[model samples]
Target chain A: MKTFPIIRVVTKILIPYILLFGCYVQFHGDYGPGGGFQAGVIFASGLILYGLVFGLDAVRTVAPPRVIEKLMSLGVLIFAGTGVLTMLLGGNFLDYDYLEHHVLPGILPTGQHLGLFLVELGVGVTVTAVMTMIFYAFAGRVQAKHVQAKQEPTP
Target chain B: MTAIDVAILLFLAITAVTIARIRDLWAAVMFTGIYSFLSASWMLLLDAPDVSFTEAAVGAGISTVLMLSTLALTGTTEKASGAKFRPIPFMVVVLTGCMLIYGTLDMPQIGDPSDPIHIHPSPSFVERTQGDMHGLPNVVTAVLGSYRGYDTLGETTVVFTAGIAVLLILRRGKEEDSKTGGRPGSAAASGDNA
Candidate 1:
């Protein structure tokens, strides 16, 4: 495999920290300042940084373009599906009060508290996957351009 | 004005000047990305973390990349009409900025509890939000996901739509190699090299 020398080592070190920060952002959304969207994008951005350093081909090896595309759609579906569920449950669209089907030992909590968590998860999934898909798409395009330029005639 | 407010105004000025002055279309676009990142930071300082998060994720990251891709797909950079002064547009922008600044003079300070925003049903929602809603302790989240659920859903749809539109336009066309300048008709010529 071709190496980027300095960039590769630097990104490798930074990747783990970015991953940790992203998780903190995700879980900490409820307490201070953060949410699914920020966490997801930051997480995807760290992976994208790795892809950039090692070259696009390596990224495709782990998360191929077709798979990334499918995951993006899946995220949207998960988010929309939750909303549709709320609609069917006799509440307004995205009314998470209906999502209070979580199981606990004794009591069942609803709406603002427990339901919001699931909904945020849906949002987080969609935002993150879609972001990664976008980065992959562009890298694929760049590679395609490189190959095409090579194929051109000199005459 | 507070230090953060001053910083935000400085960003707005930078964004405006960057938009106005940059000749290279690519550089201008990058400035817009900078503008977006700054705006997200400003919003965070304004106590609107949810909006800040959305703006940072969508504006600073995905949107900028998509814009750069569009520049790649199209060849219309053409250097922007030889950098004309364009007084009419400049005056309009300055006038709009002045109007905005003038209007802000009468507004409440950031985080002021009596600022009409926090004092309304918002406070009621903030106060009794957890008890009735049950498990969610975060009032900001509670408002976004439950009370203003439709708005949040709409925002998600908007994000999805933007992504889909970019994907559609950038998708590999039926002609295959045409997008990257390797149309199928040229395949025969390349094969002749073998």
Candidate 2:
């Protein structure tokens, strides 16, 4: 098989695992050398690498700039919202201990490990979108410059 | 000095020399990438995986590529600055290096658990990080996002600011029919039509 389809097939097979690994890193960060920041970058890098191999046009068709912008802003909000929720729940911002609470009367609850999970997910979204945005920005610049040069008459 | 230390020092020296001597801006950028790659390796050997990873992405990867593209948009030829090397500034830099080396002479041995960084507060930081924060075993996040979160916030802001600045410098210029590179007219702009 040609490399493009092979890569597509391989990445298709691997996307789920890549996502799972990202989750693992984000969740297991408290004990390891990785956490949201590293996991976010790695998650974003996978998509960026995909774009590099496949082409920018393919990625843009799948995730348009407008959608990406919305996701990017939404990601920031999601991250901030978690912190806001913790504050509303009478904890300091991002305080997991405060998040570990029984919402219903006398119900047992696990500590708010899920809070970090959500935060990491948000971070991953924002990071990937922003990195792609950066890539596109430069890509656009090169296009614009080339167009201008071509249109210009000889000196 | 240890072998790793010597290698780091050697690369660091080369980095400085390359920065000074490479007349072409593109080569300077590539050398800087090499410098960062070497530093990442050194940091890995020193058990600072997080720093190494960050350096790899931001320093060697993003920064190098960005600098090269910027050079492409601008010019690769280094403009001649017609100033002789100032002896005073040279002496000051030399003095600073000497002082830093002298300070390192009294540092704790590499990887000494009894060192202040290891003994005084780090253990407690480690111990506290485990029980506190979200359940992720990555204490770096615990420390970064929880314990000393302000610094991490600052770091994140730096990433955000850099992203914005890059976007701005690289904003699409006006394009005409003859120009092949402009965003909208080009085939690669949004990729949807493509």
Candidate 3:
């Protein structure tokens, strides 16, 4: 990947747009044909493409394994936590209608939109972390094997 | 179906057959990606843009890359089997496919307003989302995110679980490496088992 200037340059140019599109898919999902699942996968693909082009170490540096592991769990927590919050606010589990406030009538009808946003964000976060982590695991295995083979040449 | 739908479906069938017949794993993976893209197009033609988007991204983009990486770890060419033509599995597959086609005989036509799905709370969700969610525009998002929120939570949990399961199977801890005498092949061995 480092040797091919054309491939490297094209990948570098494409990555930012991919990330931006992922953001657009995440945020614009409410009004468009995308949601957290698609957005997360898209974002992960962008990072994976970067990893494929620049190498596993580069991607791992960009998204550390420890942080990704935490994020993998944190997304589920964020989603479940929202439900718990709604329950505490005198609503049924995941009942976003109760999320509405008389104070901020201008925001949107009920708390449904905000609740959706948070839940989707959680989904997006978890998905991105998990997908990227999977890529790292697989690619890391190949890298490890490559190093091992180099170290020990079979006669 | 329209001409475009027919064309896409034709391409999808050809790609699917190509993938099944191709002995080269890399070409098969590429063909599988093409099949997914065609399926996405067909989904779009059926007016399910959200499903199409998901199919295109996860099916075509991510799965292809994942399969390619898996190929990197494993053999790229499938080994030739010594067995002769097996009729039992072929008959079973044909029988199952026939049964599935027979089952679809009773299904409602595409976009039929009188379909069972179009009735029974579908209209209610679509109607209420406008007022309840304040004209969110994308009713599918509203349904998934709000109306059927619990299901989405469950799905997120499912994704989380899958990731954890994969990590457990593949990820090698430093302690495990030392315990296994720094055998790099152990991870690949476990992955193959998985």
Task: Give the runs in model 1 whose Cα sits over 4 Å from its true position.
Answer: A1-3, A83-112, B54-58, B67-80, B83-93, B120-122, B173-194
Instruction: Evaluate residue A43 in candidate 2 and report its C-alpha lDDT on the 0 to 100 scale.
Output: 61
Query: What are the Cα lDDT values of the candidates?
Result: 0.70, 0.66, 0.86
Model 2 TM-score (2 dp)? 0.76
* Best candidate (score: lDDT): 3
Top-DockQ structure, candidate number? 3
Tell me the tens digit of each residue's lDDT in model 3 across B1-194: 77887898789888888987889999999999888889988888888887887888888988898899899889899987666889999899999999999999999998899998889765676777799887788888988988888999999999999999998998877843453343335445644775
Give the alpha carbon lDDT tens digit for every residue of B74-156 in model 1.
65355556566899998999999899989999998767878897776655776687676764567777677667766766766
**lDDT tens string, model 1, A1-155?**
24556776778889899878878877777666777778888778777767767655555555655666666667667666777877898876777666666577336544445456666666676667777776766666766686778888654
Best by TM-score: 3
Better of 2 and 3 by TM-score: 3
Q: Model 2 misses residue B132 by how many Å? A: 3.1
Location of the lowest summed lDDT over 10 successive residues in candidate 3 chain A: A101-110
**Model 2 global lDDT (CA atoms, 0 to 1):** 0.66
lDDT tens digits, residue span B1-194, model 2 = 68878978798897979788878888889889988888888888888987886677667865675576567567898887887989999899999999999999999988888898887765677667555653356666666666664465455555566666766676544432123223244454434543
Off by over 4 Å in 2: A1-28, A45-59, A101-112, A153-155, B82-85, B119-123, B133-136, B149-158, B165-170, B173-194
- Cα error, residue B24 of model 3, in Å, equals 1.3
Which pairs clash in model 3?
none
lDDT score at residue B63, model 1, on the 0-100 scale: 69
